[model samples]
Target chain A: MEEKEIISIWFIIGCLLFLFGVIIFAANVLDYYVPWSGTVTVLHEYRAGIWWGAFLIVIGLVYSIAFNPWKKTKEAA
Target chain B: MLGLIVPQLAMLFTGSNIISLGWVDSAIVILYFIFVLGIGFYLMKFTKTGEDFFMAGRSMTMWIAGLSFVAANLGSLELMGWAAASYQYGILATHWYWIGAVPAMLFLGLIMMPFYYISKTHSVPGYLKLRFGDGASMVSAVSFGFMTVLMSGINMYSMAIVMKVVLGWDIHFSIWVSSITVMLYVVLGGLLSAILNEVLQFMLIWLGALLIPILGMIEAGGWEKMVDRIHQNFPQGDYTHLWSTLGSFQDNPMGIHWTGIVFGLGFCISFAYWTTDFLVVQRVLTAKDLRAAKMAPIIGASFKMFVPLIVILPGLLGLAVIPGLVGETEAIATGGHSYNEVLPLMMARYLGPGLLGLGITALIAGFMSGMAGNVSAFATVWTYDIYRPIHRMFAKTDGTDAHFVKIGRWTTIIGVFVSIGTAYLVQQFASIMDYVQALFSFFVAPLFGTVILGMLWKRATKAGGYYGLLAGTVSSIGMWLWVKMDPTALKIIALSPYAKDMAENMYRALWSWSICVAVTVIVSLMTKAKPDSELDGLVRSCTVLPSEGHLPFYQRPVFFASIVFAVFLALNIIFW
Candidate 1:
């Protein structure tokens, strides 16, 4: 029987975080060009979306690449 | 916390929806659901054997098991409810995270994990059957199965209500969508699927709620300024101190004293829930080896100690920024904010579109993971403990492992339906939700007594274990009834007229646990002792535990646990 390798949860979390960071960071950039309406929370002026998004992207990329199943499989081969 | 009361109470304070998600936010949530279901589908092929289906083939690393162990307990209701509790009771609520959890988790890792790991039992009930006779195991299996199903339902109902109140989503839509999502994933990949999702949920919970404390601190200036502002808002309240206000019932907002906090919550309820409750224990049991199994809960405790940062900080921020939040009935009568709305209100205050979506998704993830944890655990206990025993007794033959695996998968489906049915039942009679939470304590506290005695004392007879569990459960239920019928029973049970409902719970657990220990000891003394030879691998004295002495001191479970315990002590002292 062939040995099966399960994908690491870190990889999944990383992918999602990276994707969300892009979307959020892009949304904030767009908001600068065209101001959005409705309740803009306290400290919105600080642009938390951009910074938090970048933070997620960096951590997410680290986890994703570090635990990627294919990389482990290649190393083993 | 049983993860039901505050949400059930929040059901009363209905008004206009607090926050609406933008298109970007809704997309983030949708993406989360896709990923979880995708993981479940991907893992299906690997889940062939009964062991794979039920215990993830016991191949999980310490980190996976550890995170899942803690995440299973981090339900949306716990997040929202405890955050609300921080607002209602002040910093005293952090006790549930600190003293109430850390010690018990460390004790499990250091003392109890050895017995549980070496015994090779699939469930906690399986361990009981090995040590005590069939009767004790049957009682535990039934009570656990019953409560697990009820808890899943309560989680479903609580999420639905929170969604309706917060985002104007349909109640049935929230319940069905979340339940079906959980059921499909659990049914497809079994415990493996559930554990994976739990790990994912844990990460999402941190990332989602992380912004709250960050933005909250920024808004309030800093920790010191936040404390100063909180004091300015409520001059008489002791909202920042952890232990100082606990000296007298009248001194704290919680109306609880040091004894109740120390003996009742820190010892009795914490030990029972962390050590004996199979929901969390099952996660640890999935560790790949004895070392990993022993280390899992210690890792869990390290992460668990910081949970109050997200849960309690929002509540404190609510006090500083949005004061005048009243109790449930008062909020309903006066059309004001209730304590349960603290987390949602904070999200509304701090989170914008893209971030708002992540916050909402985290809440949904918390709810779904809780349901998955309950449903998966129910399937395991029901198949291994309840159904298989009956099958063997009647048929006089042990079933195939494949048959058991099939039974487990089918039971997962059935359990979800039963939980959904329970959700509607609870919606109709809301008070039933409160009892369901109380009912959990009834089983856990007593079961802890039975399991502790069975593992430590060689002379504890099967009959003694059975009767002690029965007596303790009955006494706990009796105490609950006594208080429900006459509210003044708090004075008798808690030992003070000033003691509140929270204090009553702690003291009741302490009394019930004491009764259980006393009964088990007396009964064991009278009954015939099982020989030492028959108690191998089950009791401490008879069991020759594997030595970790050859391993380096730094790699030992004790070394890590000690560091975690020191941190636990420091946090308590710093917050004191």
Candidate 2:
């Protein structure tokens, strides 16, 4: 494919992902609530710790891959 | 034990007064300064040429470029500004992150990366000159310079306010302290020092920013208690519905009145930071090759996507915990206007001694990193674009390049002082965010018009470029004035309450940006293009070279990881 075509495809995919992400986030905001105890609950409050750990793991994976492109390229070469 | 011990530790470490601050805070502050200065000093070894000073000899690795891009763009203003917005606007402000930044960043990374890849110039203005002619380049360069100076002033002013209020230092004294330290390093080390210092500052800011939310969550009786408190305290609509509660489309903080937010996120913020800002562009320019520069912004933009968590989340958590805690009366009364204080207030309330001091130190580091970046960019531009041109024109009879470099160093010192002075003066007018935004909004549209259109539109001519800029500026200013002077006109224009303050003053500055592009295009269409020979170098910069065999296999994996991030962000918004 031509470079312009690749860029246009990526742009469309990115916009779709972003729009869908927002819709999902907005829906989550609407559903946030407390259990039967008649209190309020925050999504991040309960899940922050878990999310933090997961985020770090994901970051680590991305970091490793981005920094070690040479290994894959070497094999390709 | 967890709650009581943490508070006690915070009190011991991050006491209100400078002297009362713990040894660790003092130690970190002192050590960070020394480390930054040491980096600046070390970079002297590499500063043998003007290219090294301005662009690090154009040989930086992708990693270094990527980190510096994030560091330069993130700055202290972003740290405090986003936090404050979140504090005031509730969870809706997270729109900037979840809705605004993530998509824009990905667009920049995936779609626009190729453009930057092809554009092989050192400055964005150079690209405009390549695509159009000298006139377009000159206008862009000047507007960009003006915006940088204005932004620098805002960043310095905001930092000064924090230091003065939080540390009880005098404002003038804080300005001098911050300005001198940043100026000294930037003037000596130039781009090299700025990048190295930014890397260190980024690490500090990341740790410092994270500590506030984590510790605050623990203090508010863990996540469970925090949520309970928020629901109990705030009314139903405030915390839950992100966009609806902020009032009319005009008065609403989340309203579409600030189309600039879209323009900012989509075009100006990414394009300017990635393409224009020398502090950032210098990093990309320093890349080992074209591929590295192309990849660096993607990395940087990805890093930017995560910033809402670090900066904006704390503000959101603050809202969730203490709705209306920062009373609007106090927010407006003390020129402390806006929710900028959210992070600082949270720090004061939650973080204990050792961590608090470390956090404050990090805050200072963030401010200094931004200030240093601005000073370095200003100095480079003054020396290269302005002074160098004049010197070549006149001093060809006798003056030396070494003399110009010496003058550039002096210009940097003078520029920092001027920026600090501007910061002090600008504070008297408006909120930090408003002032910075207004200042940038004026220049961004015009500059973007010239660069984007000049490159993309083959029919664009020199006469069209000049006329387009003129029309954009005039129309925006005219609309702004109508909004300001005529109260009845406010209804017609749909002015926001925040914008109503300096009616004549506000709209002129605010709307000028949107008009710039249309004006530029219309004017360009009316004129004929110059010969292709004249446009040779202009378009060449936008040409992408064949990628060297440096394609990292890991990028494919990382691309998937970014997708996962998008999914996670989606889940957070949907479930909340």
Candidate 3:
């Protein structure tokens, strides 16, 4: 695979992982404030949800557009 | 909190609603599995060689290798074992985090990396083959190969037990799902996929576990209020102090003297694990350069210093918040769930459904990473050290490099299936599991003793290495059996009312290591030593010393190790 292609694939995977974290975090927010009495446990108030979600999103963004990782691979090549 | 009064049990993960995950929670977990599997499949395009299969072709950056190194060490034991231990023993458990790990890790990074890196061996046993000879190599390899598979199986059983008790997931379901998932990634991308996934899991563990200490402090009003509550509750119990209670075995709840903690654990067990264990060292060996290899453990050590905060605090919080949690009647009635369930309980109470699902997935991720670490390491050791020799001596013609990779994958299949069987058998003969683990601990101290002498002393011989390891392992087992046979001996040793099981373990490691060193020195003097020219890069005087002297102050390992050591001292003094 080309170096460029590998970077792009990492970016897409990172984005998807970030999306998963975001969805989990959003579900928590809905549960916390929506006053829904559904038998589901929603961590709307949990700090870990937001922290992990934000961290994944940043990691995604870094992989998606960061020139540094690409440069490192180039150097190795 | 609508979850407040819906009680079957009011603690975290105390729900009876098995298989009732919300749509988002279900989707999140499904995506995690798919994404991980996808990485494995995708990376298979690149994994065509033995180098790729075993060591990721030694191209990993520090962040990738370092995170994987630490995450692989964080197993179900990290989640449940230490958490429960902290709940039972209090803050003194932090010793395992700091003095037990940091110094040993730094020693590996600073002193040991050049030899391991410069020799260019695929596994620790391969290094043994290079340094000692085929005899020592085969001994270490066979033992490591068998032990890893058993450890993987135990990892599976541990995960199953947690899921069964907490989420009511059946043991078979846990076993199959975990085994298949672990096998998929490992067989697909080999070491790289396993490691990348470990990095992800490491992040998840912190996200999942950090909440207990953070929120527990809030609930107890603050650290001071929490300490006050603990004092009021267990006034006679020395649970808050770290070293202050360690003046004597009778004085400490741990039934260990300060000397035992420092030497037996911090020196013997720590050195044996960090320096000799292939599971952890393999990650560093995959780094792109020598500097990255050295830096990997430093990064791991920095992160390790904070682990006790996540693992130990929840147990301490349990004392102040959870009613009758420490009582044995409650402990047994709940299926040993009181203390063991502390981390999950804290998660359930604090996290809602989405976060709860993620937390549980994080735990499963931790277990799978451990299983993957064991399986992958076992595959390498089996193929290179065990299978190759047997094939060469028997009917095997010379195989190509690809043939070895194929053998490795076959070993992975065999190893995983074997682990599944072992996991089931472990369920029946739980007592055997203790002996298997004891056997592993038996190897560590003696192995370290041999490795250290070989690296530093030019006169160490191959015969000495094998014989020393044999003697050390035998003595360790003999002492362990003696202690198990006579529990009264601990009382006589310490004259303490506390159970001296852990103390006995530490002292045994010290004794075993001492015996190994003594036997090796005596044996080496009697045997023919290898020529120094033959020991190039495997011994201190023969290898090029790392150029840390020319590097900037912050980049040097000594500078970082010193900082970590200083923090370690301050933490001990503060908690003293």
Candidate 4:
């Protein structure tokens, strides 16, 4: 019931998303240089992988960092 | 016509070399649906009151609210609409993303958010009731509730039509399936489920759609090569230049005068929609504090500028990669696609099946996200603004929290059915999304004019508010009919021969906004203004943003606003 616990759950989900993104990024980078016949790469070379990977990591961090409700309080707010 | 198009579309999907969704694609879509349903069902326990159902318990973080804010606008129409716009109007469509949005979003955070947050209002109509009194709230409530449902229906119809055309899915099946799925989450989990799913959809759309422009560049050799190909084939240098085409309506593909694009769209329509439309502002309202509320749009704006990369660039790339689809007529009759189909056609050519499924799912999710936002907002406004007032008046007592929550749920069901009816109505239009946007323009331009006056100038009276909204809506509708009845009226009324159809929506907003402002000011001057004491924290003079001065430099809205504004200017300059 605690908010942080819920945030932690979301943070973990974000981590999983980041993990999937990294795998896709690694595959795209590797497959660009060396072909993998059996591997199915979704959304191949048509993205900014560096930005995309960084975005996923950043979102993971945000879910971890931004979900804290008690870290700072504003009485007027 | 159904018999003809259905078989033809099936063959077109097969023989046109368009990539079809395979088993992996189907699984991706099905899994996403199930995942969202689970999120909805699990969140149901959290919704026990109207506030919880409607405002996500007002506990949303900035990014959650921010992503939902942007994602709400990223509806099926936005993904496909801008693509279609770009396919027809060229890079000029980027103005809608940047000039038409960024500054206005910044304005909402920087100027208007303090009043909204400080007032502690639940919805935009709730704010109106606080500022202008009960009558203004009722007018706003009625119009906003109607607009929300109509917009939702537009999204539903658009999703259905796309599925029917591209995947050969039944229109009724698309409508029923998506509607039931959206209803499950939104009706059960309320705003929390909707916002959370929207965040999920936002990620999917970016991850899936970023492929089109990226792979598209690779297909055309590079970004430079794509530009060269566009110029080589179309030979209109203005196609790539944003400001260049604004010299004259006759000179541009959009046939819209610069005044219309810059002032009418960039100022009037964009400001109204960003600042006032409940569908978008509702997301920002769900944030926990003024800091989160103020930061939401700024955060949304940061991600928003990159949107053209996915939507507009795909349309530009389509010019190079997909040949022989020029006008809508040509696209539909011969190419077996429409200008709106540009996004999908490019995706089909570029993405393999698994990724293709994800891409398609993203588009479908966008529609569902949009529909959920509208239906939920409609439910909230209906329960709080419209039905609550009427029920209170008739019953002579306020209902219990549980009773209101029950009414909210039932209202959501009715709202969805109304949207279904409106969705069917969309089938009758040539450009359904355009009609929807135009209808939105009619409502918002006037609403913004009234809201801005009420917030900034305390002299705006209760009588002034209601009449101004009424006059503005009526004038815009009359102007629209005038132009519709006589095409030459554009030159007569708008004072430019260039305004017609889509371009007319922009200027029509300007005219109605002018009407709202003029009527409200004149009526307020004549009638007695509301006492400033009664207007306490609702007006600009009395209101103060909570986290305005105390926040660290990096966390400040002004800081983010400055960055977004700088980038917006840089983009305009670079594109110029």
**Count of backbone clashes, every candidate in sequence:** 0, 24, 8, 2
User: Candidate 3: which stretches are off by over 4 Å?
Assistant: A1-5, A8-13, A37-77, B1-20, B327-330, B333-337, B395-398, B489-499
Tens digit of per-residue lDDT, candidate 2, span B1-576: 011111121223232442235443455466556666766775666565666677766666666677777787665556666776666555655655544445544544444444554555656666665565566667666766666776777677666666755676676876787788888777776776677677667766775568577666665777567656766775443543444443444544444344434344434543534444565665666666656666676666666666777787787778766565444355445433234456766665554333455568678888887777777777776666666656778867545656766776787788887788777765565444463555455555455555556655656777777767667656655655565576577654445444433233334433454566667667767777766555543443434435444657555424644774576467455635
Q: Report the C-alpha lDDT of model 3 over B1-576, residue by residue, as the tens digit.
A: 011111112232343533345677667777778877887887788788898899988887776777788888877657767777787788988898888999998899888877898899888998889888898888889889999898788778777776776677777998998899989899988887788778777766776667667778888888788888988888888789998878876776777889888998999999899899999999889988998888888888888888888788888887787635653346445744456567777776666556666767777878978888998999999998888878888856766889899999989989999999988887777655667777788888888998888888888898898899889989888877776788666554334436466777787888899999999899999999988789989999776675667889987767877898898889888888
- In TM-score terms, candidate 4 sits at 0.89
How much is B100 displaced in model 3, in angstroms?
0.9
* lDDT of candidate 1 over B215-252, digit per residue (tens): 99899999899999999999988899999888888998
Clash pairs, candidate 3, are A28-A44, A41-B352, A41-B353, A42-B352, A42-B353, A43-B352, B12-B345, B12-B349
Model 1 residue B284 CA deviation in Å: 0.4
lDDT of 4: 0.78
lDDT of each: 0.88, 0.57, 0.77, 0.78
Please identify which of the two predictions, 1 or 2, would achieve the higher DockQ against the true structure.
1
3 against 4, candidate with superior TM-score: 3
Q: What fraction of native interface contacts does model 2 preserve?
A: 0.00
Question: TM-score for each prediction?
Answer: 0.97, 0.75, 0.91, 0.89
Best by TM-score: 1
Off by over 4 Å in 2: A1-77, B1-20, B75-77, B106-120, B219-228, B240-279, B331-340, B396-404, B424-437, B494-514, B531-544, B547-576
**Predicted candidate 3 versus true structure: per-residue lDDT over A13-74, tens digit per residue:** 45665676678667656655774426432233445555666666676666556533555454
